[model samples]
Target chain A: MIENLRDAVVDLVYLVCAVVIILGLKRLSSPRTARSGNKLVAAGLLVAVGVTLLDPHIHWRPANIAVMLIGTVVGAAGSIYLARVVPMTAMPQMVALFNGMGGATAALVAVAEFQRFVASGAVTAGERVSVAFGTTVGSVAFTGSVIAFLKLQELMTGRPVRFPLQIPLNVAVVAGIVAMWAWLLGFAGSSASVWIMFGLALLFGILLVLPVGGADMPVVISVLNSMTGLAAAAAGFVLENQILVVAGALVGASGSLLTILMSRAMNRSLANVLFGAYRTRAAG
Target chain B: MNQEFLLGLYVLILTIFLGFEVISRVPTLLHTPLMSGTNAIHGIVLLGGILVAGTAENPLTLLLGFLGCLFGAGNLFGGIVVTDRMLEMFKKKEPAARQA
Candidate 1:
């Protein structure tokens, strides 16, 4: 009874934070509230983080505490460095890099959880499905986001990189990843298949973004952000964390809406952003 | 299907409409800044990474978690700072500067 009450209290904390986050997003409709909105979201995040760490299930051992402390210090330092020095012109790529970071974290969580289940020898098929979804989408978002960053930074030309068999190759890679994912979910909990699936996903992300011109990066970035959010949400399900699930879903929704706004601003459609079929008609 | 899933779904759907309706009203000139500002919110994953790390005992899992936290923090801070800087540009200039 006491344990149940504790769980309820923790969840209640998460609920409050979630509401604050939504209110933060809603406040973004005007520039006047935008700064405060950012602060509100940050405060919500603090609450969420505080409660998650406080959960009794986490067992914050010496090593765990050590690791988190060092990571936070390192993370804080890097963030400050980037925020201080990176010019506004390079902002898109910076944003892409950040989105990619979120994806990588989600992918790592999925991978770590799967490893745990495998060690216990109780990995279920349903769990495999969630792992497959999380790994595939998260991997794609990570690599796709990196490519976007490179393009925006002018490390690569902005024009769509095409090859003699671009479409055929992309289709083949997609099929290969899907097949591997199915195998992992349906056959057995083989690490080999999972690795192959992850590799194919990385390849797919590169191929997917390679054919899009630089002018379409805002939409690309937002779409990729949305996918990353969905991936995180899937990871949350696999981990059974209420806060992760809600926050990830919220990001997914907001990212999608932001993508739509971006596409409209560009006077292009979603299909056009993804396929570049309407490139000339829309831009010229 | 499950209770947890149902709860997540409800939040997801509600957010979809709320996000769409709210952002739809912003002017186009502010679109880029708006997107940049929201970018920091995704850093919530940093907390998730820390949770994973907290439960994980092994070095490898811990390493991955550490890296994840690092990246998420970088993303979060970079996003907020950049957004703040961009929004500053939109401030109404001194009328004297405009005339001059």
Candidate 2:
């Protein structure tokens, strides 16, 4: 019963963290409370991470420890130093880069799982579906986020880069990726095909985010955040990890809702975000 | 020492330091953007939650993960909306000041 009690404590901690997140979010809605709110949220995350480490099933393998160390150092350094050093004008681009990195990490994790499945020859249909979804979403988020970073940084033009037959080209690439995914599902061990599809989707992500202008960055950021959540959810499915799926779905849904709200704030429609078609008649 | 414990302690100290810095240098001009930028940082919570959830194999883990994502997303959206409103206010003030 001691183990049971431990589990209960962990659950309680998780619940408290969740509540903290809610309160933190509420406080963040106004400038007056933003600082405290940020602290609360960070505390919630800490609690969540702490409880996760208590799970007996979690193995502290060397690779895991190394990865965690690297992430911690890099994240701390970035937030402490780079965040302050960067100018305000570049904030949006920095956000884009971080969001993209999140997506890329999820995709890489999913790919690793797929490789394990292939090597073991124990792949199932459900696993295949999860792999395909994760790969596609992750690839899309990674590439799209990078393009967003470029546009915000002025490395690329903010104007939509529409070439002749642009729509057709995008459609064709999407189709090719989909077809490749289908083939991978059936073949069950075709790494090359999967990688190819990943490449194509990455290209699609870049193309998709490129044409969007600076004015729409807020909406784009929100939408891309949703994509990252969805990708994470896909990874959860692939890994058969409940927390991943649940967390991913929550992020995805909330992100979608936020995207809607942001679009509305700008007096634009969701359709506009999907099509990258909103053009402000009044130029700033 | 456990990695999680070390990380937690580090984050706690960092939080205290950053909090102090923010209070001392709370610029009126930066109020809006700072809030928005930090809100975007809250997006990282989603990343953390997902990573933790991806490690879970049980139903409870899934539920917690889902809830964490929801809360994080809410913060992100709410923060953006507030920032936009503030930006609008700033824009209006600029025009009025120009006229004066």
Candidate 3:
């Protein structure tokens, strides 16, 4: 009975958090309510985190607790410092870096799970697929987001970096990675191959995002956000965590929608985001 | 101690924060763009959903993953559309100002 009550309480908290997120998003749609929206989001996140920690299933291992603490400190410090110091022109880059961090965290989580499976000899087919997808998608998001950050910050050139054989090179890399992933799926104990595939995907992501110009930062950011969601969902699958799965899915769907919307805002198509079709003369 | 208490606490805290936000008023310039930008961030949910959907063994999980993807896509697209309209209005004003 106690367990049931606890479960019910947790569910209620989750529902409340979800409502907060929705309300926050709505309020944030206009300048008049943006501040309130931000506050609502912060409150929602706090509630969600608190509830998660209270759950019995979440064993507060010393290492896990320590990691969470470190993450919180770093994240808080970074956000505070950036908000105070970053120029308006560089806001886009800051966003990219933060988004990249999320993707990297998800990727690392997926990689850790893969290591656990290898160490314990408890690998399952489903687990392998999840890890494989997570690693590739997460790596892609991480690298792509970093490149975007660099581009936005002008650390890298904003102009599309296209070579004579760039398209073919990109296609080849993608094909190779896909083939390797397929092989990894079929072969049970190919850890090295799996890592290699992830590396390739990372490279592909960089290559893919690098050729895009600054005018497309909005679209790039949106697309990368979607990638991060997908990465999180993949991580959820690897861990078999229901909350992670749901949260990840929500992020992914929302990110994709945002990406599409961003494209339309610029009078560009999704195809343009994929193929580097749009060109701004001023960018040159 | 109970869900009600927790919920009440949340509401109280939220109210305080909202009040402060309204007073500061610095984030006004950022309202529309930030909303559109952050909404795009939510699109990450789709990526997560896709990953989840691919790996989920159970039917329930798969369903949730799909839903996540759907909602995320909607947000992404909707945000962009709104932003586009806002930009168009700005562009129109530029031309009108030139004529004046």
Candidate 4:
């Protein structure tokens, strides 16, 4: 009876968080309530994390606890410092960098889960698919956001970077990635295949963002932001966590809408923004 | 599919629609803040990191979990702070406050 009660309480808490998050996002639509809305969402997230710590399955390893504490403190403090110091002109870059962090987190979780599967030697097909989906999408979002950050920060040329037969090269990379994915799932089933696929996906992410002009960064960032959300959702599937899926899917929806709006503002189609196929104006 | 997976699918589908319906109503002027705000939401992956790290037994898995937590915290906290700062600019500042 106690066990069942505990489970019911946990499920109820997750459902409440989900509802709060949705209402918070709703409040963000207007400027008047935006700040408070953001805070409300943050509060919801804090409660979710608190409850997760109390989950029965968590191991109480001293080293693991120490690492989490230290990492979180330093990371949070550093991020606040960065946020305070960045100029308003650099806001887009800041968004891209932070979005990259989310993607990196998802990728790390997926990779760690994969390692666990390898260690246990008793993996199911569904688990394999979830892990693969998480890793590939997370890796792409991570590198893609980083490249967008670099472009926006003026560390690299923001012009459409087209070399000889760039389209063909990208096609070849995609084909290679698909083959590796099949190999990992079907025949090889080895750790080496996983790492190789990760590397290729990272490369593909860079290639995907490099060709878009800097002016299209808002669209790029939105797409990457959405990709990160999808990756987080995949992590949810891997972990079988309901709240993660709810939060991730919400972000995915928000980002997709923003991407469409941004593309419309630029008078470009989403495909044009993504594919670099649009005509460029002569330098004024 | 199993019951759990089916339940998860339902949750996912509902949230997606809920997200679209809410966000599409936001004005264009607030898109940047909206992006950053949603960016913070995805930081829920921090929970996943904590779970993985807490359960990890080996050094490699622990390292991955540590990095995940670090990055997730950065995203979670940084995103909110940045968005708040951006929205701060949109606030109506009093001329008297500036004079003081």
Fraction of the true interface contacts (Cα pairs closer than 8 Å across chains) found in each model = 0.58, 0.00, 0.04, 0.77
Best by TM-score: 4
Candidate 3: residue A213 lDDT (0-100): 80
**How many Å off is the CA of A114 in candidate 1?**
1.3
DockQ of each: 0.58, 0.05, 0.06, 0.76
Give per-residue CA lDDT, model 3, range B1-100, as digits (tens): 3443344334434533442342232233443355344434333333333333344334443443344334333333333333334434444666799999
Q: Which predicted model would earn the best DockQ? A: 4
Write out the backbone clash pairs for model 4: none
Candidate with the larger TM-score of 2 and 3: 3
Task: Classify candidate 1 by CAPRI docking class.
Answer: medium
Tens-digit per-residue lDDT, A147-174, candidate 2: 8878888888887776667778898999
Per-model tally of clashing residue pairs: 0, 6, 33, 0
TM-score of each: 0.90, 0.68, 0.69, 0.93
Residue A65 displacement (Å), model 2: 2.8
Q: A151-203 in candidate 3: lDDT tens per residue?
A: 88888898877766776888899998888777778767467867787789889
- Candidate 1 stretches with Cα past 4 Å from truth are A1-6, A124-126, A277-284, B92-100
Q: Is candidate 2 or candidate 4 better by DockQ?
A: 4
DockQ of 2: 0.05
Tens digits of per-residue lDDT, candidate 4, A191-271, equal 776777788888899989988889888899999999899889989988889999999999988889889988888888999
